[model samples]
Target: MPLGRAGAPVDWLVVGLGNPGAEYVGTRHNVGFAVAGVLADRWSLPKPKSRYRGLVSEGRTGPGGPRVALLLPQTHMNDAGASVG
Candidate 1:
C-alpha cells in the first residue's frame, strides 16, 4: 500500500554480530544475526544487500516515522567486534 503521509523522520541503526557465509546462516555464532533478522521482520525491513561490507536493510515504520537501518556483519565470526558508533 502507498504511504499515508510523510512525517518527521526518526532514524535507527541496528547492528548484528556474525560472519557472512551461507554456512553460518543458523549457527550459534549467528545469534545476534538471528535476533536482527527477527527485528527486521518486525519493522518490515527492505531487502539485504552487500554494499558497506555486509548485509544492510533500511526503511521507515510507525506513526512516528521511524527510519531504521539493520546490518548483519560479514567479518569472520571470531573477530565480530566492530559496530557503528
Candidate 2:
C-alpha cells in the first residue's frame, strides 16, 4: 500500500463531488470541490493529477498527522461514485 510522509497508510479518503465545467466554478454546487482545493493547498500536497477519472492529491496532514487522499470527481455529482470506485 502507498504510505504517506509519516510512513503510514492513508487514513482518510476525502471525496469532493461536483460537476465539471467552467460554468460551475465558484457556484454553490462546487462547494465540495472548492473545499477540496483548500485542503490540498493547506496540506501542501502535489497538484492533483488525473486518476480514477478524477483529480487526486495525497499527503499527510502535518509532520506526523494522518495521511489523506483527496479526490474531486470529474463526473457529475450523481455519478461521482464511478470515479471513486
Candidate 3:
C-alpha cells in the first residue's frame, strides 16, 4: 500500500473519482472529490499539485499517525484507471 519515497512509505491512498470539468463541480458524481478536499483540509495537507494525471496531496494524519496520499483523479470516472494506475 506504500506509494511514497523510499524509507517514507505512504500508509494510505485516498482516491476521489470524478469528471474533469467545471460543469460537474457540485454534482453528486463529484462527492468523492469533495470528500477528498475536506480530508486534505482537515489533515492540513498542502494544496494538491497536478501529478499522475490527477491532483495529489501527501501528508501524515496527525503527528504520529499513518502517512496518507490523497488523489483526485482529473480524468472522467470511466477513465479513472489512467490516473490511479
Candidate with maximal lDDT: 3
Q: List candidate 2 segments past 4 Å from native.
A: 1-8
Give the clashing residue pairs of candidate 3, or none. none
**In candidate 2, what are the lDDT values of residues 3-69, reduced to their tens digit?**
2335556889899888999999999999999999989989998988888899888988899888899
- lDDT per prediction? 0.69, 0.86, 0.89
Candidate 1 local lDDT, 1-85, one digit each (tens): 2211244333666788877778887899789899999888887877787745667777866545667777777777565454342
Ranking by TM-score: 3, 2, 1
lDDT of 2 at 3: 28
What's the true lDDT of residue 32 in model 1? 85
**lDDT (Cα, tens digit) per residue for candidate 3, span 40-80:** 98999998888889998999989998999999998999999
Best by TM-score: 3
Candidate 2 CA-lDDT value? 0.86
TM-score of each: 0.70, 0.87, 0.92
* Candidate 1 vs 2: which has more lDDT: 2
Residues forming the 10-long window of minimal summed lDDT in candidate 2: 1-10
lDDT of residue 20 for candidate 2: 95
